[model samples]
Target: MKSPSLSTTAYAGASNGESSERPPFLRMRGLCKSFGHVTALSEVDLDLREGQVVALCGDNGAGKSTLVSMLSGVIEPDDGTIEVDGQPTYMTSPLRAQELGIATVYQNLALVEQRDVAANMFLGQEPVRLGVIVDRARMVDEATRVIQRLRVGLPSVRTLVGDLSGGQRQAVAVARAMLRGSRMLLMDEPTAALGVRESRRVIELIQEVRSEGQAVVVISHNMEDVFDVADRIVVFRLGRKIADEERAGLQREDLVSLLVHGCRSEEAGER
Candidate 1:
C-alpha cells in the first residue's frame, strides 16, 4: 500500500467550534526519537484539528506508543518541534501538557475505585468553600451538567466508579479530562476490554467528544472501532508512517494489508 498524500489545506481548515485562523489544535513536524542505537521514530509529522477524530493504527512496536508518550510529555523527543495553536512550546512534563489543554486518558483510566463519579470527575481540582473545604453540592452539579451535555448515560453522579460498567467508567474518565478545559484528548484503547454493547457506548462517547469540538487522537487496534469513529486514519509501521488518508475513501482491507505487510509487496509488484 503506497502512502496517501496528506492534504495540508484540508487539515488546516476550520471545523465545528474551531476557528480557521487559529493555528491547528496540535501540530508536530520532523519529530524524531531514539534510544541508543534503536530509532523509535524518524521525521514524523502529524496534525490534529479540533472536532476531528484521527485514529492511529499500527501493529505492536510500530512507534505508536512512542509518539503518544512524547505527546503526553512522558518523554522528550530527541529532535523535532511541537506547536500548539501555532505557537512553538515545550511539553517537558505531563502536567505541562495538561496545563496547555492536552489531556491523556491511558488504558488504566487512573480513576479511584472508591470514589463516586462526581468525586472522580473533580478529584484534584475540586471546587472549594470560601475558606477551605470541598464543595460537594457544586461538584455534583457540575458533574451532572457535563454528563448531561455528553449524554454518557450514567445512572447518577453519586454512583461509585467501581460499581459502574466498563463503558460508564470510560465515560467518567473522558468527562474528567473535559472538566479541565482540555482542547485535545489522547485516548489509548478506550474500548479495549468492552463487550459489543459497551463498546458501542464508548464509540458514541468518542463521537460526542468530537461533536463538542475537541481534537481527539484515538490509539486503537480494533478496526471496527477505528472505522466507526475516526474521520481519518494514520497507519504506522516500523517506526514510520505508511499511510495517512481520510476514512471516506479508505477500505479496511487496504489498511489491514498495510499493517500486516508494509507497502504490500504483491501490490507493489502489480503497480
Candidate 2:
C-alpha cells in the first residue's frame, strides 16, 4: 500500500490570515427544498470544519437524503445560501460541486462490478498516454497509492471490485472520491449491511480520512458507528433540524430520543 501524496493546504485552516476563529470550512444557511406539495427541507443551517467528522442522523422521511443532495449538487436548494471559505457560491450541478472540492459517496458504492479495483478507482478520469491510449500502469500505481493511503487492506489493484468484500468495495468508492481531489467527503451509510468486522473496517477508514485533514459528513442511523467516528452529531426531524450537539457530554439515549420523538429527554419532559 502506497501513501497518499496530496497537499491539504486548501482545506486546512490558518492559511493567509484565515484563523480558526473564522467561519467554518463549509456553511449552509436557511436552506430549503420542496418537491410538489411536500417540503423536503425547511430552513436548515449547518456548518462543517476541515479535519472534523460530523454525523447526520435522522429517521426515514427526516430529510437526510434531501439535505445531502443539496450539498452534493445533485439538486439545488430552492432558497438559501452555500458558502465555501466564507464566500457565497452556487452549486449548480454535481460537476460544479466537484469543482468546489465537494465529493459524495452514495450508498450504492457506484463501482463497475466487472471492473478491476484500479479501473474502478479511475473510471472516468483515467490517465492517458501520448493523448491516445489509457495508461494501465499508471492507473494501477495510483490506485495502489490511494488504497495504501487509506490503509484499506486489499489483495491487489488488479483484483476485480466484485470479488472484494463489502468493506473493500466501500473503500474503492471512497478512493474514487479522493482521487478527484475532494476536500470534503460526504458518505451515505458507508458501513451499512456488512459483517461486524467489515463495518468496523469502514468506520476506521472514515477516521483515517479525517486524519488526512479533510472535512467529512457521514449519514448513518447506526448510533454506535456514529458515536465512534463523529465529532459532532446533527439530527433532523420533519424536514427541520432538531438537534445539533457536540459528541462531548452527550448520551446515547439523548440522541435516540431526538430521532424518535424530535426532542431531547428534557425537552420532551417539558412537553
Candidate 3:
C-alpha cells in the first residue's frame, strides 16, 4: 500500500493553532477490512489533527461506517496500522477506545429515554460516594458543568431525556461523551431525522466542540451540514478513499461528482 502524503498544505495546521510539525492526533495507514467475500475497506489512509473537524462524505456502502467502526473499537481492521500520538495502538474494544479518549456518538444518540440528562450523562460510569451509593450530587454537578461548557440550551440536566427534542438529545449525548473525558468524538449522521432548526443546533454544537480544541469526525450525507462544519472533507468510494481535501474552494457540485462518479471533472479529464 502506498503511504498517504502528509506534506501537503492541506494536512498542515489546525484551528486550535496546533503546529503542523506535531504528529497527527490520529493516523491510519494501509487500513483494510473485509467480510468473507466483500471488501468493506481497502488501503485506506487517514489523518486527524487536534481541534479540527473532518467530514466523511460518501454514498451508502462507501466504507465510511466500516472505518468509523474500526476507530471506535466496534470492530478491528483485517490489516493495517493505527497510530495515536505517533505511537502504534490497537482499539480492542469500546471500553479501550474510551480509555484512549475516543468516543462515538451514533445517530440514535444511545440515550436512555426513561432517564434524566444527568443520569444518562453518567450512565455506566456514574460516580460513587464511599463506594457504596451513586453520587447523584456529583453526577448532576458535573453534568451541569459539561452542558454549560458545550453551551447546550436545555431546560435542565434533571429533565427527562425522552422529553427533550432531538437536538437537545444530541446535546445530552455529546455532553455525556465530554463528561467521560473523551478528546475525540466520532459522530455518525448527527443531524439526521431532525427539523431544519434542530439540525442547525447540532451543527453549532459541532463548531463549539471544535473551538474547544477537541477533534471531531463527522459522517454525514448532508452536504450543507458537511460544508458548514468540516475543516476538511474526505470522500470515499467503493471501499477506497478517492479524495481528501480542504473544505475551502471545494464546490458542492465537485463534491457531488466525487460522491456519485468517484472523481471530479478535472481529475476525469486527467485520467
Predicted structure 1, TM vs. truth: 0.89
* Clashing residue pairs in candidate 1 (N, C-alpha, C atoms within 3 angstroms): 1-263
Q: Which is better, 2 or 3, measured by lDDT?
A: 3
- Please give, for residues 1-271, the per-residue lDDT of candidate 3 as tens digits: 0222222233225453434678888999999999999999999999888788999999999999999999999999999999999999999999999998998998888999999999999888989989879999998899999999888998899999999998899889988887778889999999887888888888878877877778899999888888777888999999999888877757778899999888896767522
Candidate 1 stretches with Cα past 4 Å from truth are 1-22, 264-271
Off by over 4 Å in 3: 1-19, 269-271
Largest lDDT belongs to which candidate?
A: 3
Instruction: State residue 55's C-alpha deviation in candidate 3, in Å.
Output: 0.4
Which lDDT tens digits does candidate 1 get at residues 239-262? 888888878757777888888887
Sorted on TM-score, highest at the top, how do the candidates line up?
A: 3, 2, 1
- Stretches of candidate 2 exceeding 4 Å from the true structure: 1-19, 269-271
Best-performing candidate as measured by TM-score: 3
The residue-level lDDT of candidate 3 at 6 comes to 24
Pairs with steric clashes in candidate 3: none
Model 1 global lDDT (CA atoms, 0 to 1): 0.84
lDDT of 2 at 175: 89
